[model samples]
Target: MMNRLFGKPKPETNALQTLDKLNETLEMLEKKEKVLLKKAGQEVEKAKEYTRSKNKRAAIQCLKRKRLYEQQVEQLGNFQLRIHDQMIMLEGAKATTETVDALRSGASAMKAMQKATNIDDVDKTMDEINEQTENMKQIQEALSTPIGAAAEFDEDELEAELEELEGAELEEQLLQPTTVLPSVPAGRQQARPIPKRTAEEEELAALQAEMAL
Candidate 1:
């Protein structure tokens, strides 16, 4: 009972070995059957010869021996059939055992892998990946954001700023001179202002004017 409990079952190998042994036995049985058949034929031939020689008692004895040999041959033939049946069954069992062993190995490997990676570990790994992805997304968003993205500008302040720029541009335009002078004709020339003289020259000019009068 202890041996049975601790014994390793190699069903495939055992089945193959059993089949080989059965086949060897079958071969022996076939040889024996062939020999038996030959003996039976010889006895039949001897019986016929005795009958032809008119030895009736001798022919009957040979016929009886021939029947016994025939029975043994028939028995050997049945044994061969039984051996063939056992070999076929052992081969089928060997194939079945191998298939079962392969399935068992596959199931064991899958169970080992399942033990190595639990559902909780998978969930944790996925959660970490998602966290990293979200962090990277936030970083990208921060990089893509323009400067002062968070600062809000009032509409009134923006309008005032635009108006100031517009007013400054208008004042600069007003400070520039605007002239619209007409063009003079070439036939008419304007006289220049006369120079002021000294008092003696003015008196001399007056005396000359009196003398002329």
Candidate 2:
């Protein structure tokens, strides 16, 4: 009833809205500060003119007004500083809030995942995968084996056949004709030179030849 009477005490403003409000206030303070500074400068100029005219009282009054304007400018500067500080703190708080919210969302998602899956389901899936792998291995082994590889063979009969083939090859080689080469002459006959004989030796040779005839 109290809320109804107060017309629903307006919703709490968010960080962005608060920061925008602060910026507007800061801008207004700066504008006021500028106007005050300008007024102080004008006061100083009026004081100078009064002093030149030898009106000491008027110059003193202008100086007092200048002091007041400077004081107001200083106050505006302090207000701007407070606004900037508030904005910085609010932005920091906003960042912190966003970080917390992100962490909370991640935790909730993890909790949901945990609820959906259990250890027994994981074990069953692993078992199915292992069975499939074993079946695939068996299929591969079956395909790689040669046909009739399980049939028995007679090693002794195979050896006997190999020996028979080798014997036939040797006999065929022996049936081929042998080649013969012509014989070389022993040596060539050479003419021998007669030795020069002395006259007595020649007569003795001739006498021997006559006696032989």
Q: Each model's TM-score?
A: 0.62, 0.56
lDDT string for model 1 (144-197, tens) is 766684456676988999999999999999999999898778998777889898
lDDT of each: 0.87, 0.90
Best by TM-score: 1
| True-structure RMSD, every candidate | 21.5, 17.3
Task: Output the worst ten-in-a-row residue range by lDDT, candidate 2.
Answer: 6-15
Per-residue lDDT tens digits of candidate 2, residues 88-178?
9998988888898889999999999987798889999999999999999999999986658444566788899999999999999999999
Candidate 2 clashing pairs, residues 3+ apart or interchain: none
Task: Identify the candidate with maximal lDDT.
Answer: 2
Off by over 4 Å in 2: 1-13, 127-213
Angstrom error of the Cα, residue 133, model 1: value is: 1.6
Residue 122's lDDT in candidate 1: 97
Candidate 2's displacement at residue 64, Å, is 0.8
